[model samples]
Target chain A: MLDDVVFWVLAVVAVAAGVAVFRVDSMARATYALAVSFVAVGLVLLLFDLQFLGVITVLMMVMEMAIMAIYMIMFMGMNPALMPMSMVHAKRPSLAVAVVTFVVLASGAVLIPWPSRRGAPASDLTVSLGQALMGSKMLVMMTVSAVLFATIIGALVLAVPRGRYDRLGDDLRGRVDADQPDGAGQ
Target chain B: MTLQTVLLVAAALFSVGLYGAISQQVVVMVMMGLELMLNAVVLAAGGFWWFLSPAPDGQVLLLVVITAMTVEMAMGFAVATLLHRTRNEDMTDMATDLAQ
Candidate 1:
């Protein structure tokens, strides 16, 4: 009873915010809508007893949104606050495609024969997860994480315009903060 | 809640995401759309794991999906940043040429 009600409420909030992501005028507002949408979805995940993932989702999204806000300021500095820009294109065709995709997916969700519910989960779900991570699944987890690290370095290299030569002296032996040409690092 | 109900919610979220992804011309907006779609998939997977299977494997898969989604957005933003820096533009239409 209560679960159903909460589920419906959060699900509606999530969907509403998802729609607002595009309908809103400013880019910052769209990011806020997306963050709200995910937070609602995280709550729904918690309602479904996915405690860890739900919390992680909330944390990760908050941080991600902060990064997005910074990105907005970093790149779109023309209007300062409003952005005063509308970037949408091919409105009619996109709307048609969206409507068709929604109808097809929603109909499939309603009509398809899904699998039956299995037995209850283990008493200690987190313990089992930890054990699996340290056991057979260890390699995959470790490799994926290593790849994630590599991607971080790669992304930084690709995105940042400055390097050791620009920040430090030509010998790469400049002081921590004072040796740059611009005196801005200090 | 029933599995069907959860699945329906996921579908709705995915559709909204699709709409945004298609209609938006800004690169970051498109990435946000993709994030929302991936968010729907994560929730749906959680629903199936909770209501249908109660399996640890599904949870693991869900985590992987989450990781992939995060990495994808990060990479996308990196590319957007690069494009903005060099080209001083961030619209999808402005980024049409690949031969550069």
Candidate 2:
């Protein structure tokens, strides 16, 4: 009974914070609201006995939100993210879509005849998870690592306005330029 | 406690995210919506694993989804940074042309 109560409470928190993400005026508030939502969801995962995933979710989401807050502030131009502003557009249609989606999904959840469990859970879930990663799912782990590396490289490439060659001369042996204005290289 | 109950929560979270993603004008706000949706998926995946399968494969799937969420957010921030730096615009309506 206590577990059920906790689950319900976390569910409310997760959903409410998600709603607040769009309702809040400032970018920082919206970002943190989403973070709260994710943390709540992580706690729910913990309730499900997914200790590692739950903990990782909490850590990753909090860190991601911090970085995202910085990016939102840095890129919003003239510090408008700090000021109150309308965060949404085409509000009516979006509301309609959201409502319809929720109704459909909720109905499906309630109406569907789910399958029964065929076997008991592993005694050591985390150990089994580690073994799976190192065993049958090894390829997936390798691919995900490659993808993460590529994402890091890709994001850096897209974000940096000045290339190495632009900093150093085309021949790659110029004095380190200093005190250049933004967009001066172009 | 039950799978249906967990799924109901996921559906609610996902719908809110859909609303935000469709309505939000700012790039980062849209990305927040996307993250929220992924957050819902994580919850549902955990619930499914606990109540139905109870296998390590489900955990692996959850890990992959979370990783994808991280990658997506990183790329989103990068694109937002690029857009702001190059065009001085952050609203989606202002960035109508990709060829520009």
Interface RMSD of each: 1.2, 0.9
The digit string of per-residue lDDT tens for model 2 on A139-182 reads 98999999999999999999989876677778977666667554
The regions of model 1 sitting more than 4 angstroms off are A78-84, A164-186
lDDT of 2 by residue, B12-74 (tens): 999999998899888888898889888989988888888889988999999999999999999
lDDT of 1 at A158: 73
Kindly report the root-mean-square deviation of model 2 from the true structure over all alpha carbons.
Answer: 2.8
Q: lDDT tens digits, residues A105-157, model 1?
A: 88887898988888887777767666667786888689779979988987897
**How high is the DockQ of candidate 1?**
0.73
Best by DockQ: 2
Worst 10 residues of 1 chain A by lDDT: A177-186
Candidate lDDT (C-alpha), each: 0.83, 0.89
Q: Which regions of candidate 2 fall more than 4 Å away from where they truly are?
A: A77-82, A166-186
**Would you give me the overall lDDT of model 2?**
0.89
TM-score of each: 0.89, 0.92
TM-score of 1: 0.89
